[model samples]
Target: MDFDNFKTLGEWDKWKGALAKAVDLGEAIGFNENTVDKMAYRIGNFLSSTVDPENREERVLQELWKVADESDKKVLAKLIVRMVEKDSRLH
Candidate 1:
C-alpha cells in the first residue's frame, strides 16, 4: 500500500478507510489478530511521534497516546482495530 496517496486524502474518514483496507489486506495475507494489533500499535507509535494530527479525532488519539501506559496503549490499539473492523463491515 502506497501511503503517499492516503497522505493526499487527509480527512478522518479517508484515514479510517485506509485503515479498513489495511486490516482487510492483513487478514487476506493470513496475519492473525495479535499480529495486526501489534502492527497497529507500531503504526500508532510512529504517527504519534512523527506526524501531527490531521483532525480532531486524531488529535484526541494523540493526546490519549501521550498519557497512556504500554498496556493501555495496547488496549487502545485493540479497540481501534475493532472499531475499524465494524466500520468496514458497514460499508
Candidate 2:
C-alpha cells in the first residue's frame, strides 16, 4: 500500500493498515505508541518524498531523525528503514 497518492478514505484505510503493521513491528522491537507514532509520521513523509524510489539510506535516516526526538530518532529510523527494505526485497 502506497501513501503518496492517498487522499480518499479507502486509501487512508490501507495506509492505516500499513501503519498498524509498522506499529506492530515497533512494539515487537520494544517501542511504545508515542514512539511508534513518531516513526509512522516519519515513514509517511519519507514515502511522500519518493523520487527514484530505490532509496537513500542516509536521507531516510536524516529525515526520520529530523521528525523524531533525539532519543527515539535512531530507533525510529531503524524501524522505518527495515520496513521499507524488507518490503523492497520481496518486490
Candidate 3:
C-alpha cells in the first residue's frame, strides 16, 4: 500500500506483485481496464514529476516519460497495466 516503496523496489517480481495488487484494488472499486489505465497514467505522471527513481525499472520509465509526448505516455501507462495483468495471471 505504500506506493513510495515501488520506486525503490529492486526485484522485478516484487514490483510486479505490488502493481498487480494495485490493479486488484482498482477492480475492487469497479474500475475497468480503460479507467484503470487512465488512473495509471495519472500515477505515472505524479511519479515522474515528483519522485526520484530508486530502481532500474523506475529509472527507465522516468527516462521514457521524459521523452514521451502525452499520447505516448498513455500508451506507456496502458503497457504497464498490461504487464502487471500478465504477471498477475501467473501467480
lDDT agreement with native, every candidate: 0.90, 0.56, 0.89
**Between candidates 1 and 3, the TM-score winner:** 1
Q: Encode model 2's per-residue lDDT on 1-91: one tens digit a residue.
A: 8654344445534544565566667778998756765776566456646633223444454565557665675566456545654554454
Estimate the TM-score of every prediction: 0.87, 0.37, 0.84
Pitting candidate 1 against candidate 2, the one with the higher TM-score is: 1
**Candidate with the greatest lDDT versus the true structure:** 1
Ranking by lDDT: 1, 3, 2
Task: Give the lDDT of residue 63 in candidate 2.
Answer: 63
TM-score of 2: 0.37
* RMSD in order of candidates: 6.4, 10.7, 5.9
Kindly give the stretch of ten consecutive residues in candidate 3 with the minimal lDDT sum. 4-13
State the lDDT of candidate 1 residue by residue for 6-27, as single tens digits.
Answer: 6655687788989999999999
lDDT of 3 by residue, 15-81 (tens): 7799899998999999998999999999999989999876777789999999999999999999999
lDDT: the better of candidates 1 and 3: 1
Cα RMSD of predicted structure 3: 5.9
